[model samples]
Target: MERAISASDANQRFSELLREVAEGESFTVMSRGRAVARVLPVDRAREQRSIQHLLKFVAALPVRHAGNWSRDELYE
Candidate 1:
């Protein structure tokens, strides 16, 4: 659940908010009853998961052995 906090209050307790965010807590900053911003932890695990998925995708691609053609032959 996202906690609602006023902009001014959020500014006053930014440090405490950061601590909560680090612990997986999310907050929505409101301005005049409208949500203006969100404070959440960086999704480091999601990034790692994406990289792992990409590695698996690459590994599944067909492998090709090195060809004997000279590098300059194609340009000649």
Candidate 2:
């Protein structure tokens, strides 16, 4: 779960929060005891999404039969 940060604290330490978020730490900014916004690592999110999409694409690909080869060639 992402950690919660009150609006005031977020405002007071915006620079530090941004640095931490950029380093892959996520946070939910709260207001009046409720979540109002979120902070996340953009690069990490994009990389994770790209990797997941690539994995799904690879998984859906059809497997090809292996060609017959001599025992020595197979071992090599």
Number of the top candidate by TM-score?
1
Per-residue lDDT of model 1, residues 46-66, tens digit only: 999999999999999999977
Q: After superposition, which runs of candidate 1 have C-alpha atoms over 4 Å from their true positions?
A: 49-76
> Which RMSD does model 1 reach against the true structure?
6.0
Model 1, clash count?
0
Please provide TM-scores, in order, for all candidate models, with all chains considered together.
0.60, 0.55
User: Can you write out model 2's per-residue Cα lDDT over 1-76, one digit (the tens) per residue?
Assistant: 5799999999999999999987779999999999999998788778999999999999999998889789999899
Query: Looking at candidate 1, what is the lDDT of residue 67?
Result: 75
Q: What is the lDDT of residue 36 in candidate 1?
A: 99
lDDT against the true structure, per candidate, is 0.95, 0.93
How far out, in Å, is residue 17 in model 2? 0.2
| Steric clash count of candidate 2 | 0
